[model samples]
Structure formats: structure tokens, C-alpha cells
Target: MSTYEIALDSKAREVEWNNAKCDKYDYMISVFCGLSAGIIDAFFVGTPGKGRLGQWTDKTADNMVQKIANMLWTGDKRSSVDGRPKNAPDTLEKAISYLEQSFPVNYDARYGKDLINGNAISGMSPLNHHLLSLAHSPDIIGLLFSIIDQFTGKATFINNGKLIRLVPVKDARNNKVMYMQGTNFESKVFCGVCNWLGHLISDLCGSSSTRKVGKTGRGAGLPIPFYNLFLLMDLGKFDSNSFADIAVKIFEEGYDLRHGAAMAIPVLIEELSIKVIWALKQHCYAKKEWKDCIPSAKHADLRMMLLIGNATLCLVDGIDAAIRTGIKGGNPITFILHLNLVAWARLVMLVFRELKIRYGSIVDQAVGKYLAQIGLNDAYSLKQYYERMNAIDQKLDSVLRDFTFKVEDDYKVFIQSLNYTLNSSLRTPEQGRDVSVAIAKKEGVKSDRIFRSQEELRYWLGEKK
Candidate 1:
């Protein structure tokens, strides 16, 4: 066995049969992996569920903000999700049907094709798609809601030099918009926009990202309120204008990366690691031949060790790159400290991955029984969601499965028709894995799978097992 495989076996040998301990490891890994994907999903490519809400699903924050800023410069009203068409934002069909007569003069030519082709961006990575699968899953919506609820809070803000606490005020449409006490911005500013009756507003014109939290008011040393990103969502459409709405809110809130590297690095690394692990996990489960290959507990442990070990190595390399970049910029010592934290965290995850591989089934059974006995269920909901989504993706794959590029010169018409935006960038196996790992670190996306090299083709064909 390889050195890493031996280490994994050793770690697996240290597993204990404690339900609580196993649950802790399970939660840790899932949260670290899932939340990383969730945040990226929430930010970059708002899932269909969040997109239906007109949230930040258009593009990356930087992309959206820059595009909108350019549009604003050129007086482009046709810059919204659906452009200047008379379509409601509630539905995708209407959004597309109402595309404006023309895009902005300076708009990227690709944007027009992307918008019309319904492929504004490249397909999401496997990890991102996995999180999105959960996002769109009816079963896990409540779980996601609960996770968001943990970070939900009423934000305290300063409006027109007056410190005020926000409270929700329902408009005639029954949409809840937060209001500030002793303020006339609702009647004065917001009323002019919609002319609704008895509408109120907060003092700061609207929800401020630079707001305070529960008893401890905003101050010089207080940590930035990351939760406001969620709270602002509750503030309704008035709070959302562009994808950058959340990004700007996060920036304006407090404790930027430069200011709070100590606290920030871990949060960044944790999220980064989550994306890495999630992308790796998808490949592990994607092996159809390996589905029943995990027969014995030992076999399962070895498989998991391979999965976790690869992911950990990828994450270590990513962080190591960041560390090197930081060092060259004269921040070597500070980066060393950050690297130490990541190293420790990496060790914990490896140990947990091994133990979970051994005792995970036992923990699952215990948790299942406990959940059933208490009426709190859906222990396998995430798995079910992934399977359903993967099935759909597989059906789409079937349509193209027979079209091998080795004889591509014969079918011209078929190729032209298949030029849709969704799968424009097909991958060879070697390129695919490298792209998967690289993009997962750089963009938090997993792109599509590619199998070109001999070993990879064998793996993809299920001949390697």
C-alpha cells in the first residue's frame, strides 16, 4: 500500500463505536463540506430556488456589479436579469420572453449569446451541483431554512444619524419589509416608489449592512455582522437590486479580510476546504462500479480514505499556494500562522474521515432510530436528493453518450444543433480532473467530468475496479 493508504488504514483502526462521537464527526464533515458549497451557491449562481426569488443568481458578485456599473454608465435599463422586456421577474419563461430589443452598446457579445442560449455561465462544478441539488430538493428545503435561520437576526442600523433597530413591516402585498422606529423614510421615500398605504421604513433609508447585533451594539472592535446577508434577504426586494447587493452588504458590514486576518483566514479556509471535500466526494459516489464495492467495512474505509485523502491533499495544495503568495508579498510569518491552523484542521478531518468510514454506518443506524423515535426524520434526505438530481443529469448524458468525437468529422448537422450553451466546454479526462481540482479552489465550482487519458478512460468505463 502507498504511504497515504497506510496512514488511512491506521486512522481507521482508531475508530470507536460511540454513536455520539460518530454523529459529531458526521456533522463536522457535512457542515464543513455542505456550507462551503451552500455559500458559494448562494453567492455566485443562485440556485433555481433562490433564483426564482430574484436573488443573486445572475453572475459572480464582481461580474454582476461590474456589468451593472457599466450599464448604469451607458444608461442601460435593459441590464436586469431579463433585460428591458415587460416580463415579470417571478418566472424564467417570462424573464426570457421579455428580452429587450437590444443589449447595451458595450455589453460583451458573449452575453447576448449566453442570455439567449440560456447559458450565461459555464455549468456548475460537481460540488456546486451537489449543493444546488440540495437547494432545489423539496425534502431538504426545511433543512436549508433551518441552517439559514441559525444565522438570521434583526440588524441594528444608523439611519440619518439616528441609531435604530429594524422590525418587519408587511406591505399591502403581504411582502415583509423591515422598518425602523421613529422614522419617516417609509412614508417619505419608500411610499413614493410604490404608493402603498401605511408602509414604514428604517432610519437609514433601508436595511444597512453596517448594523449592530443583539445586545452588543456596533463598535470599533466588534466583528463584522455576516448574518446581515441573510437578514437583508428578509428586508424584501427593496434590499435587493443586483448580485452585488449581498456582496456590498458583506463588505460594508465590517471586518474585511485585511482588517481581521486572524478570524477571517479560518473562515475562508474552512469554506475553501468544504468546497474541496465536496467536489472530491461527488467523484467517489459517482463510481457506479464502486456502488456495491463498499461491501465490507474495511472496503468502505479504504474507499473513503482514498476520497478524503485526495481531497485533503488538494486542499493542502490550494492553501499552500495561498501561503506562498502571501509570503512573497511580505506577509510570510502571518501566513505561516494561517497555514498552521489549516494543517491542524486538515489533520482533524483526516482522522474524522477514517473514523467515519469505519463507524459511519453504525452512527447512521443510531441516528435513524433516534430521529424516527422523536419524529424528526430525513436522515437520508440529502442522499435521496443527490440520487434524484444525478438521475436527471444521467438522462441528459444518455442523449450524448453515443456521440464519440473520435469520428466527429462525419456528423456536422448534429454537432451544430448540439452547440447549445449548457455543455459548450466538453472535457477530456485529463483536462477534466485538473480543471475540477483547479476550479474548485479558484471559483468554488466543479465543472464537468472529463476522461481522456488511458487510466482515466478505464476508471470512467468502470474497468479499473
Candidate 2:
């Protein structure tokens, strides 16, 4: 086949080689790994508040907030001896307060009444306003809205199946106009990004005001990453609450970024356990190369195993959530709160990805077979093709070298004879004719042949057709 065809075939083989198949053994092992992780999730990661892992994640988030607060704390309110800010807001609440004062935004509207006029956003309250407001999300959506709010001096909110933008009521206590800092565009972006991050960090746990009030409840906090997307999904109605309302309720029940982090634990456990086992099996049992044993998503076997494993985990989590919620009189909100949304989301993604890969593989196999039937099959392996090309190149190089050496030697001899003839007497007509006859004999032509013109002479001398 042609080089191009060979190259295309080689690439197809490479892809096929990478997409390793999963056997029944692999699937069983993956299920076991998933079951182990699901058991941990059901027992340790029970619900938002009641689960031990959830509490640990909450404490970890608090510590993270405190550390961030300490970093953002620029006030001279510190004890000289211990280096800890003494009575100057060292706790998470105080740190949040410092961040609030340092990076204040105009969009601190809590309720619909907090707007300039009457109620604009229905059901808007301190508890759910953050969920409705895109800026309060601890993800890319939040970053974009935060930057936009900072520049436009307007707040953006989504509520009651609508997106609303409004001029925020100015804080009469602090009349300072919020402006983007820095001299250049890049510096301004930097300042905006820093401001956005600081603001989000401040709101990550809960508002400083709410925490300071000493209310022992899940106060308003930043939503989980990308959880704001659910606000757009206002279709479903579960027990009089729309999907948006359910999302709000979920956030209200402490399924914020901290709890999201907690939910990640069991998902991660299942993912890692499956990957490790797959890699080990590939290397030890399958006798694959170390490099080939990597559990990348490109491998069909690994993807399938991961799909099965995460599916099992989600299944167990669902059952657990159902049981817990059934005991609580089958409350939908309780069921959602108990469910591991992270695992379910992962399983959905895996399903789509696996379907896509399988579809592509089927198409590829059909195309490959058709091409092979048409005699377009690759004849030479990549290595064999390269070796043959190399041999041909070497042979051509040797032939060219020999031809070059002969030309050089012939040129030298012709030049020396020309020089000798120039120094000697001019040849007579008879001598020139005799010389032509001798040249014809040397060139293996008939010496007695007569030539009429230069063209005829060239033809007789075998120099032209």
C-alpha cells in the first residue's frame, strides 16, 4: 500500500491497542471495590449533619477558612507574644469580618426588600439569596458575576425562573464607591480576581454577621461549585418544591462547598481503589508493560471498570438515602440531602463517555473491515516500512557516490587533454577525421559511418536518439 495508507492503518492499530478490553474478572473486581467504597459512604457519610465524615469535612473547611482569614488579615490586631491575632478576630467569624470590610461589594442584598424598591425576587431571603445569586457560587460562575458586579455596580440574581439584574442599594454606612484597582488592564484583572476570591472565601463558610449572632444553625454560605446550574433547571416538582427550590433547600441543609468536599471522599475512594486494582492487574496478571499499565480513561477496560464501580457506589448510596428518608416519612428533601449527588453525577458522566466510546468503536470497526475488503489493508508494519525505506536510501546514496566519482575522473582527463591539444599544433582535416574515427571505435560505434551535421554526428556517437 501507499505510505499514507500505511500511516493511517498504523494509527488505527495504535488506537485499538490502547483501547484494551475488560474481562468478567475485571468487572467483578471493580464491583467489589465499589461495594467497599459504598459501604463507607453509607455508614460514615450518612447525611449532611449526622454523618461523621460530613462533620470532619465541616471542621476541615472551618480550619481552611481560619487559615485564609489569617492570611487575609492585614490588621495590626495581633498579640506580640504568640503571634496569633489576640482578640482581634482570630476565629473564623472574625476572619470573615476582616475579609468583608477589606473587600466590600455593593451586592449584599439579603432579601427582596433589600433591593431599591419592593420585592423583586420572590422567596428571596438570607437563607436562599446566596443560592439564587450567581455571584455567591464558589466556582467560575461566581468569578464572572463577581467581576461583572464589581465593574457595573449592579447585582445579578436568578429567582422564580427568571434572571434579574438590579442596582444594589448603596450602604449608607460606607459610602465609598467600589472601583477596579490597578493601573493597567492586567493589573486590574489581577485586582478583580483577588477581590473576587477574597469575597468568596469570606462567604465560603457563612457571613460574618450571621456567625457573630451566635445562631447555632446552618447559616447562609456559598453554594457548591457549579451547583448554581441547578437554578436553571426549574422543571421538576417534588412535594410542591420545584427543582430550583429543591436545590435551594439542599443548600439550606448545608450541602454547600464544604459538604460537597465531604461527599467527594467516598467517590474518590471508589475511583482510586478501582484504578489501583486495574493498574496492578494489568501489570501483574496481564503482563503488560509498566507504561501500558497506567489506568488512563483512554483504555476501554479502565473506563468500563470505572463506570461499573461508580455505578455500584451510586446504587448503594441511593438505597441508603432511600432507607434514611423512608424512616423520616419519605421526605424528598431529606432523601436528596442524604443522597451522594457527587457519586450520581460521576456515574452520569461515565455513562455518556462509555456510550460515546462504544459508538465510535463500532463505527471504526465497520469502516476498518470495509477498507480491508477493498484491498486497502496495510501490507507493511510501520517498523518494516521504515527499514525498507532506509535500505532504499542507502542503496541510492551508494549509486550516486559512484556516479559522481566517475564524472569527476572523466572531467579531469578531458581537461588535461584539452590543455595538451591547445599547446600542440592544430590538427589537419585528415587528422581530425582519423581522430573522429578512433573516437567512434572507442564508443563501440561503426568507425566508417559518415555524419552530415552535428545532430547526425551525435546520433552516430550514441550521444542522442
Candidate 3:
């Protein structure tokens, strides 16, 4: 002791802070962090154990039902041992109280007010920036859903009782309630599976010309209307029929979903029902917009990253209608039909990508040379390039103008090709029955595996020509 006059290390300050935080969440650490030291447990340690930790690692199919039940009903309770420290949530009752305190009953009253008042909790990691933990702990599912229910209320501005609106959580910019972004697990599962099946069909039938070939540009994520789709699903309005049928109905209706993209012309065609055609048209239009808004041909790599955000505005009528119709009443065939519609959209995107690539290559080969001749460099900023172009020789100007005309013509070709494909695919018995019958009759004899008989093929094609 006399020889040991060692000074405290500078790193002790960080250690002390970590120790304090660990002490605060000791119970949660014990329940979730396995046998790691308390300091190591403050942040997620991704260990193997029971209770909070078990759900993350245990993937046995048999345990799934029990896991779900636990998430729905179980409460966190810590064990009392000679060596372990006792925290406040020492029993199931206390655990419930602890959870409630941590998550809160009203989102708007607590976190919402803070966000609206410009005092939202800061220091969020970009990747996992969720305010509340919705992972691992099954109790969190119950807690979050319960919070949602508490926040849900009648709209004061319109359709009071008829609409069970979620209370405004953040300050409305133009007086509107902000809804949650991202599709819930239910919708994701449904849509993801449907998407997979659609892809499978594309692979087998070559329905889609290319696989995931587009940049998916800015504003390419699910539309604001799609967010409401999730909200409507959360409301538990859709009927108890098959999930497939519900998905189909939603796609067919198109729900008047918002469309966003750069350059688009509304496609009109007489084929299937007007609603189905409209959905196809919107899909094309939105993709067109996405293609146009994305960075230009020179900066194609920049298009790889997507910036996703949800609309703060919520339409009461949309939510109300979803609840009313979705609660019950949807055709089972709708999902299959919806998949076909999505298939068509996928083809359109692939075709668009091909056109973009082809045109971009042409520009790079021909116009790029002309631009370099006129002192244009790929390294130059768009503004710089534009200014230089304005000062180019009249002959060079004509060449640039001709290049632009070619690009526009290419764009027109892109739109027309997609429109033609859509018309051909969506063509109903009434629109192209004669052609379909001839094609089917010729192909039917070749595929006894698909068509049991010529008669079956006729019914399948909806014609007997």
C-alpha cells in the first residue's frame, strides 16, 4: 500500500459513466444479456439464453407458437440470488410497471409532445434509430400495440365516430396527423410472399424480362398510399377471409395511391376492369417519375442509395373506408389477379431499365465525344456543364440539340413499348379475344401438360375462336 500511489486512469471516467447506465438497467441486462458483465450488457450483446434472450436465438419451428404466446402474455420477472443484485422489477407485477414506465401509455403525450416542441430525443444511430424497441422482447409487441390503441381516437375535424383516427403524435405542419412509416410484420409477410411468388412466376414463365435491374431511384419506396395500406391493416378492418384475396382486392382497387416520379404520361387502354388498368397505369407512371428524378446518366452509381420517408398527412376517409370494407367482403381471386398486375409492372420496370442503359450508352459514345470537344468534362458539375454548353459553337449547339431530340425520342419509345406490352397483356376477351384464341389454339396443342384438352385451353383464354 505504501508503494502503490498509482493515479486513477483517465479511461475511468468512461467506465464510471458506463457503470452508472448499467446499474440503471441491471434487470433488463440480466434478462437479455446472458452471462456477460454488466457494462458489456448495457447495449445489445446478442447472447444466448431464456426469457428476453431466448426469443432472439431460438429458431426451432416447434418453439414458434410458444414464442408467440410468450410475447403476447409473458411479463419480465427477475430472479433473486445470493450473488445477483435485485432491481425494481423483481416480480411480474413490478415488471409490468417497469415496462409501462419505459414505453409510456400515450405516444403523443410523451414522445409526440417532445418532437412537436422541437425537443425530440437526440443521439440516435442512423441504422437502428427506432425510439422504442420492437424487437426480441415479446412484451414489447403487446406494449407497442397497446400504445397504438391508446393513441387511437375519433377525428374531431371530420367523420368523428365513424373514423377511429390515430391521435396526432408530432406537430402538424399544415394541420395533419403523422402516421408511422414501414409496413408492419403482417403486411410485409403477405406482400413479401406475394412478391416472391410473382418473382417465381417471372423466373419460370420469363414474365419479367429482367430481375431487379432498376436503380429504384429517389422516392421509389412504398408510396404514402402504401403507408395507409399498413395503417388500414393495423386497424384490423379486413375480413377474416384468405390473406391472398385481401392483397388482390387492395391491388385491384389501387386505393388511389399517391404517384411520385420524374417523367410519366398516364396510360389509357381498354383491357381488364378500369380499376385494374388504372393500377397498372399508376405503377408505370410512378416508375417513370422515379427514373426521371434519379441522378443523371453521368452519376448512375449515386442512384444505388434510396432515401425513404413517409407522408405526415393521413386521409380520414381512406382509413375509414379501409376499415369498413376490409372488415369483411373481398374476393379470393383478387390476390392472383393482383400478382398478375404486379408482374406487368415488373416487366415495365425491366424494360425501362433496358431503355435507360441503351440510351445512356449511346450518349456516352456519341454525345459524350461532342461534349468533350466543346470543353465539357464528366468531372464538371451539372451547372458548370450547362454554362459551358450555353457558350458552345453554333454547330456544336445543333449537335447537342440533336442529341437531346434523340434522347426524347428514346424516352417516347420507352413509354410506347411499355404501353404496348401492357395493352397486350391486359387485353381481355372483349378486346383481343380473336387473337388470343388463335394463339391459344396454336400453342394449346403443344402443351398438353398445361392444357388438359383444347376445350380447357379455350376456357383459360376466355375464347373459342
Candidate 4:
């Protein structure tokens, strides 16, 4: 048994024995936390179009877009008469326009017709094309596709439950050219990446045209991160639209990244509230150490509480959606719009986490029972045994090393004595014969079987024969 194995076993045992107990009070607290979060979600994040939080997120996104645009702005810096830099974007709309002209792509298809290629992309339009195009997404998938499209002069889009690629055709009359402009491949990739980011920022708060119409309506914005992936799920039928179509419709109606941010607020509140409350209860009521009071998921009680809390939150959200949509004559779009996808996602994650923890516990318990039957259940005893074994192993290594040195020293001494005897007896044959006979007796050999003369002895010892 190695020290590493012993330590690992000790840690496993500690984890198994230290499982936190959740009482009825814990469950009640979790439910209360969830209810509180649900109320916030209902009041603040109602729907994409009219939710207070959604509006706030939209403004925040607009601010972010302006900031990013200003950073990417590289036009002439000459000052204008108004003291503002010439050709510089001052507002969100101007910033968006600046980006549009800076990073023009060939894949701006609208209404089933490619803007550059003149190819067909069914179910695509200015309103929902961003949702259908993978490159328009504000995620890694989008970044990769954006770079690829720039290099290939083609666009990738998901339409009618299939992937579509459209290549641009040359127009000799206009002769308007667009390509990733850089000195090298690396520079070109960098330019592509920048172009992708700049374009997404321009579309973050909606197109410049929509912004020009003022704040009376929700403008078309980029879809939520990875939300475009929903297009692959071409399952289910709601009214006349498939699930994929419904997803696109949802995005077109203001359920974009800004609204997704709004939806995250309640989920964050629920998570933080539970953790803070759990920590307070542990430290104040339970009198636990500060380190132990941390509400980490590693603690069994914390995991269970989180699972219960999120589940309750989802329940509340579902009921609220049901009631609100029912009042609107049970419109499918209304119901879908009112639904809190973030809460449901959190609940699902908690459920899977709880199941995994329970399964692991079961396996650990079975193994522990078998170990206990063999009287090897004590971690301390096992650790001590391994420690002792390691000590003995180190001592044995030292002893063997010393013994080897001693044997080598004794052999050298024996060779020196033999050489001395051979050199001294070289003058007398009889003396050498007597020495040989004596040496033969010591080696358990008969005198007659051994070398007799000095020369013969010298030959036997590897001297010139």
C-alpha cells in the first residue's frame, strides 16, 4: 500500500462520513428562496418586449455596443467644428452604422434571397436571418463560422432543418469587392475575428434602421448566445410552426441576448440568496467553523437545497406563465414568451446533479460496507500501516546499499593480501608452495588439486603462464 493510496482512501472516507444533514427547516428555507426569486422574475422579467429588466438589459447592451464601436473606431481623428472628432461615431446608431460599413459581409440574406449570392435561403428574412445564421451568433460557433465565411467568401446558415452554404457571385458592373483585408494569413484571421466581433456589436441593440424609428418598439437584435442551435431541433408542432420555427419566431419578437440577460437576473438572485442563507445558518445556528460554513456544492446539504430551491422556482415560473397566457386566451406565443427558460434550465441541471450525487453515494456505501466487514474501514489505521511499511522499505534500501559497499571493501582487501603474498614468495618456491597449500585448505580444496609452485600460482591468478 502506497502513501498516495492511503491518503486517497482517507479523503474518500472523510467525504462519506461528513455528508451534511438537511432538516425540514432547510427545505422550507429553500422553498422560500425560490418563491422570492419567482416573484422577482414575474414582476421584473415578465417577457422580452415589455419586461422592465429586459428594457434595462437592452439599454445596457446599447451602451456596450457604443463602447465597443468606439474602441474599434479607426477613422480620421481630425476635429470637427463641433469639437467632436471627424468621422467618429458619437451615438449607438452612428456607431452601428460605422461598424456596418467597416465589416461588410456577403451573407446578409433577407427574405429567402442572398444579398450577395442571389441564392435562396428559405425561411430567412431580415427579422429572423440572424437567428438562422450560425455566424451571426455571439458565441464561439459564431466566431469560427464568421472566420470561415470571410476566408471562403461564403455564408453558413441553418434553414428548414438543414445547413446551407451560399457563395457570392461576381458582379462586373458594380465591381464592389469584399474580402478579409490583411497582410498575412494570421493577420487575415485576426481581421476576420475583429470583423465578426464588430458586426455582432452593431447588431447587439438592433439595426440602425430600427433604431432610427425611436424607442416605441423592441428592435431586432442578435439572438442569445448559442440560441441559434435551437434551429437544429426540428421537432414538435405548435400550431403551424415546428419547434425550430417557433424558436426563430421567439427571437424575432424580442427574445434576443438582451432578454436572455434579463432572464438571468432571477436565477442569479435565487442562487446567491440560497448560498448566503445557507452560510449564515451554518455559522450562526449550527456553530460551524467559517471554512465549513461555505455553501459549496461539495456539501450534500447544499446540493439538495439547491435542487429543491431551483425546482420550486421553476414550479412558480410555470404557474405564472400558465396564468398569464391563459388570460390571453392560451395563445401559444404568449405562453412561450412568458416562460422562464433560464429557471427551467437551472432546475434541470440541479436534478441531474442530485441524481449523480445519489448514485455516487450508493456506490460508496456499498464499498464501505464491504470494507467494514473486513475490519479495514478505519482510515487512520490504514494510513498508519502504509506509513510503517514505507519506513521499513526505506530502511531496507539503506541496509542493502551499506552491505554492498562493505562487500566491495572486503574483496579489495583480499586481493591486496593475495598480491602481497605472490610478490613476497616469488623468491622461494618452497615458501610459495606452502602458501598455496594453506590457501587451498582455507578454500575447501585438497593441496594436490591446487597450484604447487610460485609460477603455477602466479599463472592461476592471471599472471604470464
Query: All models: lDDT?
Result: 0.34, 0.76, 0.30, 0.77
Q: Residues 26-51, candidate 2, lDDT per residue (tens digit)?
A: 88988998898899999888767568
Candidate of highest lDDT? 4
What candidate 3 gets wrong by more than 4 Å, as runs, is 1-345, 361-465
Q: Which stretches of model 1 miss by more than 4 angstroms?
A: 1-291, 294-298, 311-315, 322-326, 330-353, 356-465
Give one digit per residue, the lDDT tens place, for model 4 in 1-465.
899998998687458535877899899999999999999888889989587898898888888878777876654353555333456677777887877766677655555544444455655778887888788899999999988888777778887778878765542234443656775555777888888887887788878777763556656888888788888986788888788878888888888888989999988898899899999988899887786676666788888888888888888888999999888786677788888888887788888777777787787677667766787756545456568779999999999989867866765665654665578645465665566566667768875568766577687778884
Cα deviation at 317, candidate 4, in Å, is: 1.0
TM-score quality measure for candidate 2? 0.70
Work out the TM-score per prediction. Answer: 0.22, 0.70, 0.19, 0.69
Per-residue accuracy of model 3 over 1-465 as CA lDDT, tens digit each: 233333344244334322322222323322222212111211221111212322232222113323432442344343444212244333333333233222222222323233333233322121111112111112334233333433242111101112122343433443432322223434433443333222221111111111123522111111111222222233333357434224323322321111211001111111112223223432464343333332332222211110000000012212322443455462333322212222234235544664565476775567657766676665775467767668787769799879867866765665554454348676653445444434445445454434444577688888966
Candidate 3 global TM-score? 0.19
TM for candidate 4 is 0.69
Deviation in Å, model 1, residue 421 alpha carbon: 58
Ranking by TM-score: 2, 4, 1, 3
The residue pairs that clash in candidate 3, if any, are: 237-326, 237-327, 238-326, 248-334, 261-289, 261-290, 262-289
Better of 2 and 4 by TM-score: 2
Greater lDDT among 2 and 3 belongs to 2
For candidate 1, which ten residues in a row score worst on lDDT? Answer: 197-206
